[model samples]
Target: MKKSTLALAVALGAIAQHAGAAGFIEDSKASVSSRTLYFNNDQRDALSANQRSARGVDQRETATGLKFNYQSGFTQGVVGFGIDAQALVGFHLDGGRGHHPNSNSFVPSDTDGSAVSSWSSASANVKARFSKTEAHLGGALAPNLPILIASDGRLLPQTFEGGTITSKEIDNVTFNAGQLEHATGRASSNSTGLAVNGGSKESNQFRFGGADWKVTKDLTLQYYYANLEDYYKQHFLGLVHVYPISEGQSFKTDLRYFDSSSDGKNGQAGYGFNNNGGYAKNANEVDNKTWSAMFTYALGGSAFMVGHQRVNDDGGFVWMNQGSVVNGNGGSEGAGGSSFYLFTDSMINSFVRAGENTTFGQYSYDFAALGVPGLKTSIAYLHGDNIKASNGSGDQSEWERDMRIDYTVQQGVLKGFGTTLRHGAYRGSGTGIHDQDQTRLIFNYTYSFL
Candidate 1:
C-alpha cells in the first residue's frame, strides 16, 4: 500500500513534532452507539476426525459509532491546539456462515472467506497541551491505557491511527504515553495497513509508559510500560484498597502485577514466534510474573470475594490479548483474563495463561439498598493449574464459572442508559479446548455537547 503510506508518513512526522497548538478544540461533540449481537461456538478439537462436523451457531449483530470533537483553547499562551473527529458504522442484522457463522465473529468477512454485511471508518485527530498534559496527533480512536485496547466485542469497539499522551502534573500522579501507527480491525471496513495475525511485517510501531498513584483516600497505585513494535514486552502493577468495617460496610483490596517477555521480531534469534499453529515450540518465550489478590466485603446487599494468581515461568504471562479493544478495556490491568492477559474475560473465553498458577473467587451485589437504583450484580469463579503445553504433551487443568448483571439509569427517563448481562461456563481436561458456554449483551448510549 505504497509502502504502508510511506511508513505512515514517516510516523506522522514524529507525532507532529511534539504537538503544540493550544488547548486544541474549543467546542463540538457528538456521539452515537448501537449494538445488538449474539454468537456461539463449539470447536470440537478443530478437525481431522474426518474434519470434524461441528463449529458454532447463533448469530445476530449490529454496530454503529459516530463521534465528533473539536477543542481549542491554548493558542493564546503556553501551547494549545486541537481537533478530533471520528466515524464508524457496521450492519449485519442477521446470521451467516449458514448459521455456524464461522463461529460467531458475529458476521462480517470477505477475503475469499465469505460472510460480508457492512463496515466503515473515518478518523482524525490533532492535539497539544501544556501543564497538566495532553498530546494527541491524528487518526483518533484509542479506548484506554496501555498500547492498543479498544474492543467492544463486535458491533463496534476497535480503533487506532496512533499518537497519545497524558499527564496530571504530580498530585495523585497520572501519566501515560503512546505511539501507535495503524489498526482498525474488528471485521474491518477499511484502514488496514498494519497487520499482526495476517503478518506482512507492516507496523509503524508503538511504545507506552504509565502511572497512577493515590496513596490516600483509600490508597491506589498502578504502573505500566508497553512496546509492541515487533510484538510484545509489557509490565504492569496495581493496588486498590478501601477498608471500613461498619455502617454501609467496607472492605476491598485488589492487587495485581505482571511482567511479560519478548519483543522485536518476536524476540529474534533464539526463535520463539509461533503465535498460533497449535504451538509446541518457540517456547512462547518465558520470564513471566504474576500476582493476584482479591478481597471485597459489603453488607447492605452483600459483597464478598477472594483471589489468587501465580505464573513464574515456563511461558505464561502474555499481554495484549488477541481481542485487544484499544489501549485495553481488558482490565485486571495486572495482566491476567482481565490482565493485558485474562480467564477470564468471557465472550468466548480467556481464562488467561495456559501454564500454571491461576485461581479466582468472587461474589458481588448492589441493589441500591433494595430500591434497585441502577442495580448491579456479580458472581464469579475461576481456577487454573500447572497447565504447561499439553495434548501431545502433559501437565494440564482448568475451570471457570461466571454470572453477571448490570444496570445504569439512576434517574428518570432512562438517564445515561447502560445495561449488561453476561453468563459463562468452561471446563478443561488437558486444556487444548473443551466444553464452553458464554453469552453477552451490552447496551450503551452517551450524549454530550457544550
Candidate 2:
C-alpha cells in the first residue's frame, strides 16, 4: 500500500475507536469483497464551431476499476447497530494525452491520439440498516438528487460526501433525505470542484424529499422537492400506470411535471459556470416548468413507446453536474455521452426544468423467443422545444436518437460475462446547443466470495 493509503486507514480506525466504539462499534458480523469494471467511449464526426474537424484525435477512452465492499450486520437485533462500506480504486488505460479536450470523461481522443496517465482515489461509507430501510453517514461517493447527480459515464465512477436516510416501513411509500457536502469530478481522481450542466463553477448543497406510492397494483404516483444552496429550488410530480391485455400485451404510461427557479446564490448574480472555467455576465435568473409523458405498448416480442415534454419559458434546463457543490453528490449515474434525462430518475430530485417541453419515443424487442436468452435491444428518440435563453429568445430546440444493446452470459464457460453498448446522435441550433454523436461501451463482471 502507498503511504497515503496506510495513513488513511490509521486515521479512519482512530476515529471509530475514539467514538466510544461501543453501541455503534460492535456490529453483528463483517465481510469484504472485490469488484472490477471496464469502460470505453468513442465519438464520431466531431468538429468545432469553425467547422474545423475538432483538430484532434477522433475519440476513445478506457479505464479499469477495483472496488472493495464491506458490510457489518446489526450488532444485537431489535435496533441493531450496523455499518456499510465501499472502497474504490480506478486507473486510466486508453485515454490519450492531449485527449482531455472537452473531456466529458477524461477521454475525447487527445490531440496525439495516445492515452493519459492513470489516476486513482479511495472513499468509504458508513451506514445503519434495520427493518427494510437504512440510513448512511459518511463519505464515499453520492448519487444525489435535487440540483445535481454525479456523472459516472466513464471507466471508474464518481463519489460524494454526505449523509442519507431511507425508509420503507409502509408498503408503496418510501421516504428519503440527505445533507451533502462535496463531490469528486469524474476525470479527476480526487474529490474537488463544483459545476452545473455546462454552466459555471460554484458550490452546491442539496436537500430533498420524496415519496413513491403504489396506488394500486398497476398504478403508481410520485412527488419530490429539492433545494440547492444558492442555486434553485425544484418541485416534481408524476404518475405511472400499466394495464395488461391478452396473453402478453400491456400498455404503460408515465407522466411528469416540474418547476424551477433561482435559489440563494445563483439568484444573486445570475452568472453561471461550466466545467471549463468561464463565466457569463448578468446571467438572468431563470424560471421554468415542464411536463412529459411516455406511453409504451407491448405485443408479442415487440414493444413501442411514445413520450412528450414541454418547457414553458426561457430556461435551457439545468442540473447539478458532478463538479458542482450545491447538493455535493456524485456517482456513475450520469456517465456516458448524451442527455441524462431518461426515466423519471428523480429517485430524489427532479432532473427536468421549466420553459422547455420534451417528447420521447422508443421501440424494443426481446430475442429470447428467437433462441437468444440474454440479449435485448432498444432504440429511443427525444425532442425538446419552447426553450428560453438569457437573450430573451425562444425556439431553441434540440433532439437526440439513441440505441442500446445488452447481453449477459446465462450459463457456460463465461457464465457471468456481460456487455452493453449505447449509440447516440444529438443536434441543436441557437441558445448554446451543440451538435455531436457519441458511443459508449461497458463490460462488467462479478465474483462470489462468501
Query: Highest lDDT, which number?
Result: 1
The parts of candidate 1 lying over 4 Å away from their true place are: 1-42, 46-76, 86-103, 106-114, 121-128, 135-140, 143-148, 151-165, 168-349, 352-427, 430-450
Go through the candidates in order and give the clash count of each: 38, 50
Q: Which ten residues in a row have the lowest lDDT in candidate 2?
A: 273-282
Clash count (model 2, backbone only): 50
What do the candidate models score in CA lDDT, each in turn?
0.57, 0.57
lDDT (tens digit, per residue) of candidate 2 on 242-263: 9998788998887877676777
The segments of candidate 2 whose C-alpha lies over 4 angstroms from its true place after superposition are: 1-57, 107-115, 130-133, 141-150, 193-195, 198-201, 269-282, 324-355
Q: TM-score: which candidate is best?
A: 2
Q: TM-scores, in order shown?
A: 0.31, 0.77
Residues 1-450, model 1: lDDT tens digits? 645345445644644553453332334344655555454443344444333322223333343433333333434357655556667666655544434334233444554333556666677666667878988766755647533456656555556766778889888888888776666655555444342331334546667788878989889888888766665677888888898878889998878777766666764443243332122234534345667677778778888877777665344555443332221221111100112333244445454453466677778788888888778888888877666652324366778787879898977776878878877777777666756566666676666654
